[model samples]
Target chain A: MSELAIQTKDISMSYGDHVALDQLTLNIEYGEVFGFLGHNGAGKTTTVNILTTLLKPTHGKAWVCGFDVVSDSLNARRQIGYVPENVHLYEAMTAQENLRFLGQLSGVEDLQKTIDETLELLDCKDLANRRVGTFSKGQRQRIGLAQAILHRPKVLFLDEPASGLDPMGMKMLRDLIVKLNAELKMTIFMNTHLIGEVAKTCTSIGVLNQGKLVHKDTLKNVMDRFGDDETLERLYLSLNTQKVA
Target chain B: MFASRYIMTAALRANLRDQTVLLIAGLFIVLVLISAYLGWSATATVQDVYLKVVEAYAAKGQIAPPNPVPDTPPLGLLRNMATYVALIGALAGLVLGNKTVSGDRKSGVYALLASRPITSSGIALGKILAIIIAITGLLGVAALTNVITFMILPNFSLSADEWFRLAQFYIASDLYVISFGLLGAFFAITSRSEAKSLMIPVTIWLTVTFIIPQLTANVLPMAALNPLKAMAPAPSGAFFVFTQSVLTPISFAEAYRALAATLLDFAPPGFKFQSFISPMLTLMIVNGLLISAVVVAFGKMDASRSAYDD
Candidate 1:
């Protein structure tokens, strides 16, 4: 297996004249909880799209689990799962039904068994028969995570997963992300602008500015240099302001 | 490739579980049963009247007219069954199509679907297979309803040819229904927003089912149920040519209507399907092309970004 779970080489994406991701090179190793931070339209979702093989980058190459996203897209697709923001899945379907449908699509063997185990692991075994439409945002987010990891994918991509969550919801999500990383040894690529959530959940972080990646570092290394999460926030804000100036 | 089967199975379950589809199907079955009962009641009335006439003739010691009025077409008992399938069945089909692949698209589930090992074409094919299964199941109910009516009617009996023709009518009905389904799927996938997608198919449905039929029935007042009337060559005129050329193609529903009229043996005496083959083939080809277009559209889709499903 390649040491890296995700690798991008000078990747850029442009929509007409609007540049989304600018010649970005990035590397994330297996089992790393990667928090990709950016303002709106700063290419966080775009990067997630490219990594998940949902969109192809215009100017460069990307690989997931050593499979080129464009060329070996099917193989790369097999190695990953994605949960987009506010993805209220098949609202009419029960939790088990939705997971069964997705798990089968993901080609998980023994799907019913997998669904039972996955729901249990996500702490929602009792809610399995309830319709997703009835669940709160935090409960739905947990179900969303369950679906993403149903196939035991090598890497999982979540785009602004905590966007609509309350404080308790956010804390629950952080704990869930940590549990997934520890128990499954799964690499997680989360896109978020919340510095607190990032400091709590992500092991490594990358900050992007105006479509360009401006900073990349391990959370431990950054905290050692900056002293604390608040100092890191100040550093992030100052960098954005400097770019603006 | 294996995922294709799973997708197909899931799609079938999802389609079957859909409440709207089930409701439409239930309504269709009730309508079919009512139609069958009406046919049965008519059969009893006709038999009772015949027995009275025979008894009267025997008492008077007069010669009977030697006329046995046979219900010429076997399945003619449920003649309105065709229209029901075309109208109600097409609605069911449209519902099925809109909710299958496009449901996932609107709900943002296709992003996860795209992340799976299945190819886009595979997923589309799976849904297509599900549509076929759903349509077939519906048509089977229609056929069974009519067939049971045939077995129970006292004086009515089905000839071998009539049996074959009844089956043929259903096959054509399946084609007619699926064309609308393809239309529904196409619009569902390509429309800019979920709310707007339904309008395109509904407009087409209204035009094809009610509007076009009414127009054609006005032009050829008995076009739907009457046997084709043999006529001389058209006069050299613009209106005649447009009616014969432009309007006929757009009124593809008439193709099924005419074909059903012939199979039910209600065609004007001496009318052969040879004259109607062109229209039927045209409808089939047009339907085939539309389904292929939807498949190609799916092939080119950016699975990551949905077209505003909700």
Candidate 2:
């Protein structure tokens, strides 16, 4: 109902003495493919965790689909789906079984029909009955995407879903993300350190450096300012350099 | 509360498909049958020996050798299954439960499962329900096989009282078996590694099964159902009596063996259901607490945090 599908204000997270995310604030409109860019330990996943209502923020507030991340977490969870990094799911079970389990949790109706449709949509219909244990990494990613989209979430959160995939797998995932956003009218929040993937897939980008968001803007606007893809890298390095300075 | 059917069924399917569960369950069946066969053959041998001696006396030998003590109540002849329940049945349950959380970790599904709309308590309950089904199904089959074997063996038909006692014995066995399962699950979900979690339950199982038997007085083969064997030392001082009274309730294996013995009519020294009720209650309470602990542990876990202790 809100103009933004995801929103956060001055959220900070700490584990004992160390802070993983700090005063991070951002918002994404209903249909943007927002790419979260940061190196390891840059708080990208932490931010994704907060917005997905998985972790409560130590300071500030977050809202997913107009539900408070802490207070209205269940409703927030219902409105979003997550695919974590290195997500190997129910290897002993077939893809259909995995879908049934997660589908029921999401309260989907007619799970079997929906699963068929999802697999068809993702071009994984043939692999539906195969045990996930036998699946290649790329095939598992397809299943992951299928499950996340099974309930038709308003916002899908992906944590480095492209990290370890083969080149073809990455391309298929890219096309799938684009298709889900365009055809399903869904919003996407993708966490990645891979800027090239962002250039190819994400429309909006935010770069986090050392637990803080150092820069954020529309890709086109960023390209105009920096002049090219190579300068985008230069800009990112300069931002991290400024933080360390 | 979301429907746990999906999760519960998945877990049960995994349990059913697991080779270790199958192997342990198979071994339990074999041992139970072997124990029954041994009891039946031993009873037959005693009867045959007595008859032969009696026939010799009639042919002009001295009076037949005094008859060996006959096994009484007929139900006592069937108690080998009880001991199996205490050991193998418990291990079967233990093996099923210890893998629940660890299974998720190994399959890389905990993060995925935790992210769903369901509460962690719901997830924990689903897992517990699956274990309950797996263990019950396993032990139920073992019980059924024993009953069938008893019917087939000559001179081993069950009377009404024997049937009731047999049922009671199994209830006790099921309770004992489930407790170990819960204990193993507790460690699996709480600990950081498989080897560490595994060692805890097995160590306790070994301690309860073997070491404690050595330490107790009735330490004999058939009479030490209550392993404390503390009665003899009690005459020495009030301290021994007090200690026995305190420690008896904590010995689950002893409690189960004692309970099963009384129900089966072995009635080890001064055996009465009333005396063992406290220990049975302890077993029941411990099981309830373990199931609740699993639910609470999962509920309190920080799902938002990436990765498990594993």
* Best-fitting candidate, scored by DockQ: 1
List pairs with backbone clashes in candidate 1: B227-B268
How does model 1 score by TM-score? 0.91
Error of 2 at B85 (Å): 1.7
Cα shift from native, residue B147, model 1 (Å): 0.9
**TM-score per model (chain B):** 0.87, 0.83
TM-score of 2: 0.91
Instruction: Mark the regions of model 1 whose C-alpha exceeds 4 Å error after superposition.
Output: A224-230, A243-245, B209-236, B246-251, B272-280, B307-310
* Separate DockQ for every predicted complex: 0.74, 0.71
Candidate 2 residues B276-298, lDDT tens each? 45656877988899999999988
TM-score of every candidate: 0.91, 0.91
Colliding residue pairs in candidate 2 = none
How do the residues A32-133 of candidate 2 rate in per-residue lDDT, one tens digit apiece?
Answer: 999988889999888988887767789999998898988887788889989888776887889998998889988999889999999999999999889998
